[model samples]
Target: MRMTEAELAQYKRDGYIVFRGLFSPSEIAILRNETARLSAIEADTVIRERTGGVRSIFRVHEADGATRSAAFGALVRTPRVLEPTRQALGTGEVYVYHTKINTKPAIEGTVWMWHQDYGSWQRDGCPRPDMGTFALMLTDSSEMNGALYVVPGSHKRGRVEPYYDESTSYKFWAVPKRDVIEVLKQSPAPVPIVGPAGTCVLFHCNLLHASGHNLSAEDRWHIYISFNACANAPKFTEKSRPDWVVSRNTKPLPIGPDVLNSGTEAELVRATSPN
Candidate 1:
């Protein structure tokens, strides 16, 4: 689906724009099933919370063989996601920097500290902030279930200084609390990105955002596909993370049809394979 002129303008101003029910219920159901299967696998890519719950699954776009989910492999190529991402980055040629599924299990889920994604990516050697993420909700997200909170227009500040934070269950480069407070004073109040299953939010990489702990009985699950301009591929750095986390593959992805409707697992893999 193509983005409207208004949607593009909103993204430029707000640093994010939400598309309600962007994916249909059937598609989201497929993703939810795939998420459960991936979370149960014991692998290095499956990062766990301090409580041993699955925190996130990285490089989901690379799943193949018996582990592959045709639905998810197709998601990476789906124009509904890729087209707008191309528009946001102002480049028709783009590659997947990485893809991840973040899961906050009921009651036991942990908090993600306030930070700009670019804060971590910059250290990975990305030269510019010309990147965006398409975060699709696999389950309904609400204030009680740890919905993401984003400071509108915060991306205009560009990359804010970040401190390495280990205070949370998951370690990440976080914006200092003092800096966050100062930013809040100048920008609008942090808005909770609340929405139903299948809703999607495309956000700027430099946007300041965070999420609280899940206080309700329901789980919170969201899959993120981060895209960068092919010309903006990162340079190797001493601090560069693993390929799964920081991909070295800068190949521009070829858009695929809605494979979810017609392809088998093996066909889908071949159709979208980075190789």
Candidate 2:
């Protein structure tokens, strides 16, 4: 799980890196098995949230995903993911802000536009440190499974404007062709992650990134955990998934609000509150 000086330098300059075997075969088996088990339940089990009439996939924390996969949770603290991040951020003072799983079905039109992760946490120009996001593949990920597309080193451009709307998938869930061309022409080309079932990608929150369509024969499932340095972060942000929660550990975060809760206080509040 050791990240070399060269790899750390690459992340700082190139913006993202892929580690094909972040999880062992047995570990991947457990995750895939559990994910299938959850999906088999009759009901949609998945909760959905809307932003201006657009439905964003959301699933309840600990309800749809495994509650006790130490192997998986260990990813949050794993040297494979953390050491590199610490090297990139130059500190181990980190916090696990939030986590959510992504499962994209095979579809010719499915898309996630290229955008930075900053806007979701920024409010009123309160400059804050961006979170580091890691995507772990539960299933084999490829261009067919709508693999992620990233504009190498785009984080240097500052936060790109995010556009959302209810009109069409291509509109809200697409990276502008101009930006794609701009990055390609001016910077390194977007790299398509190609790997076996257990590939993991670590990306900076401010990286201008987007995922491609998953028209292949396999389902592309990914779980992302947001991590941030305890240093220089804002107190809170005005955002929530309503379907997921954030768990706090030794390191603290400066986030405003979230739709999901995982702390003991939140559980107590949910218990006493009427459904």
Candidate 3:
């Protein structure tokens, strides 16, 4: 469904909007099962946390030289996701950038440093900051389980300086701690995004956001589907990451209806597997 004017206004003012229960329980179950199956496999792209625990499984949609599941493709193209994207971008054309499922194990979950996703996109030569992510909850998220946190209206600051941290062995594209503190001084305190499975958050690419470590007894899982305005596709011919990491195809996604059914887990496993 298209976002209401009030929702659009809030996104303009706050850089994010939360939609509670956007997906049904059964729909969430389908995604959760798929995530579990994909994450168990060992792949170079499936990164681990700093402590060497499973971090996330990227590109769940595109697998085995084809789109993995009809349900996933439908979810990506659903008006529930695409309408808001088009409205927020002020453009009708949108293209898939990538998608990933972040799995944070209880007790051993690691923290994600505060960062704007656009910083990395800029490095990839995306001409404008017209990208955003729709983060859908696959498992319940609570403060005790490392829920995502965002600084209200931080996207207004646009892209900030980023540097590499050798200790983390990952490129740290987030702003400095002092800058974050300064922004916090002017903005409201970080808001923890906590909700049950089926909740979703749509945030601007340049929004300053992060999540703490999960310490609760249950695992926390969420999928991030990034979309960019077709007009803002990357300008560079060469890419630094794999196709799954950053899609080479810029085709606009076609909207479809929900495909959820009362299928057994085993049935879903076969349906979602490569043809």
Candidate 4:
């Protein structure tokens, strides 16, 4: 489950790396089902597009009781995910800052403007950029289906000052067009992250990335789990977003059994619950 030296180097040089077919088809099926169940819920955490299509569901890793997904709970603790995350962050321990599923439905999916994730994380009061995100594709992603596009090695540029924009269909801080242009000038063309279901893309916090609208007839869904070094947890504030968006729990996660391979719902819950 550990990252090879070559993979680590590629991540360092490019700010991200993609592992195709990292999870089994059965595991992806479970995640797809969990996504469907969560999407139907009536909650603030389930953000929808202007057209009423489910956009993103936040804090999925912490879901409890009827809403909980044992599969996702186990995913956070999976060695294939955690070990590489720990190696990439160069930290002994890490915690889930938050987990979210961003869905782009057929032709109704909207665009996510170019931005660095740390732009929002910094505003959330996280002082350091020692964070990474593991995005697991629940459905096949392709150019026609709104695959993510990332600028190679953009993390080396550090955090670019982002402006808050509410005009977009989804409101959030976005990198200015000028800044993105400048970054693109030095780097190779932005790479579209296209892969089949069960693919995982691990990227640095400051990596500049965005996704286009889904013009195809197929849906694209991906669950992203943002991990923060335990030593680099954020400072909470009255102005900060809800805990569902910015997790308050800073406890390091314990590695658990591979539920994708074998583990009952009760065992998965007990293994991931806080001590």
Candidate 5:
């Protein structure tokens, strides 16, 4: 669905927005079924399982079964979410950079760290702001299962530095923490975007958001998908992110694919920042 003018304004000002009914009930039903099937057969098998040992997070990129989930692909390309993304980011064609399934079991899992997405992508050669992604809940999400926490206005702030030590506590990477807090000091109260299964939250690449751990018994399943608009998009280097990428680039640059990777816009914004 096209975003309302108010929603669009909020998106532009806050750098993100949460739409209540992202997926149809039938669609969500199918997703839950598929996820259950995947979970039952591959619970201990797919991707990164509880690295914290506390039981708050499960990274699903380590296994092929997780990599190729059909439900995930459908959600990423769904026009409801994609169209708004295109209008916000602007691109003829968009690419889903990667997909992440975060399963927060009720009694286990650690809290998601507080940091910025851009802290990592400050690499020499990588697509910066093509698009950053947020996940859609496949199951009801809450503090019991460590729902996501976001710093509402941080997306419009100055560049975020990497978290050297606590960085890894977030996703794949992060920058320093002191720098982030300094920027966040002027922000509003930390607000956790609330929603049920089938809801999608989209944020800007540099939006400073973080999620906490689930302290309850219910499982919180969220699927995150990264994407980028088709043009002005950094050319795909030979070796890049496996999720959404170019098979080939017509207008090539000096960098080769081995390193011109694709990641959330936060990475690109931080890395490419003139600062």
Candidate 6:
């Protein structure tokens, strides 16, 4: 579950690293099914894009009865996930800031502007940029399917000014287009993180990245597990977004294994829904 020396070096240099098939096929299948079921449900957490496709389903890991599901909980807490997260952040302990399914819907998903995740975190009053995201692909991500495009080593640039745009199809505070162009001129060639369903991309919070539209006939579903050092938790009490979006819980995750198989199939099915 821990990263090798070479892998750590690459991550330090590139600002990200992809672990292919880090999760087994059986585990991936369960996640895919669970995501589909959550997306179909009528919930306040499920957001719709301007194109009328599902935008994201937030905080499934912290959702009511859903949190009782062993599989969903383990996806974030298991050593395979948690340990590397702690290592990358160089923190002794960490907590799930939030976890959600970000969907690039088949045929109509829109572009995510070039941005650093830490920009938003900074606005949330997190004093440090010592956080990162682990994205688990739930479906094959190809260049044509809106795979993530990252500027290698861009994390070293630190936080950049976000172009505040709320009029777009997907509202986000992004790095301005002009800044992106300049960064591209100096940075290494942008990398398209293409991989299979079980692939996981562990990326630095300050990494500048974006994804284009999905013209292909397949959805790009990625589960983002964002973690923050327990010592570096946000300081603001006044929040702009829902608690689910910005987790209120600062409790460190407990280590466990095989949480998915710990319960019967019937139990998992019943626990997926909050109601």
Quick one: best TM-score, which candidate? 4
Worst 10 residues of 1 by lDDT: 62-71
| Candidate 5 local lDDT, residue 217 | 71
- The better-scoring model by lDDT among 3 and 4 is 4
Per candidate, the number of residue pairs that clash is 0, 10, 0, 0, 30, 0
How accurate locally is residue 69 in candidate 5, as Cα lDDT from 0 to 100?
48
Ten-residue region with minimum lDDT total, candidate 3: 163-172
Evaluate all candidate structures by whole-model CA lDDT and list the values in order: 0.87, 0.58, 0.80, 0.88, 0.57, 0.82
Compare candidates 1 and 5 on lDDT and give the better one.
1
lDDT of 6 by residue, 109-214 (tens): 8788889999888888788999999999989999998998999999999999887878556576888889899999999999999998889999999999998888
Report the Cα lDDT for candidate 2: 0.58
Clashing pairs in 1: none
Pairs clashing in candidate 4? none
What candidate 5 gets wrong by more than 4 Å, as runs, is 40-45, 50-66, 164-171, 232-275
What is the per-residue lDDT of model 1 for residues 129-183, given as tens digits with 9 covering 90 to 100? 9899999999999999999999999999999989999976668899999999999
In model 2, state the lDDT of residue 91.
Answer: 71
What residue pairs are clashing in model 6?
none
Q: What's model 1's lDDT at 206?
A: 94
Residue-level lDDT of model 4, residues 1-275, one tens digit each, is 88999999999999999998899888888788889988899787888898999988888887563345777888999898999999899996899998989999899998999999999998888889999999999999999999999999999999999998786556899999899889999898999999899989999999999999999998899999999998888777788798877888888888877877554678767767766
**What TM-score does candidate 3 reach?**
0.90
The predicted structure with the larger lDDT, 2 or 5, is 2
Best-matching candidate per lDDT: 4
lDDT of 5 by residue, 1-275 (tens): 67788988998888888988767666676656656655554443344434532221233322233334434444444557567776677654665544556666566655666666555443413445556665788887775567887778777774565645543333444535676567567888777776777777888777777666667777777777655554534444555543222212222111111111232334423332223
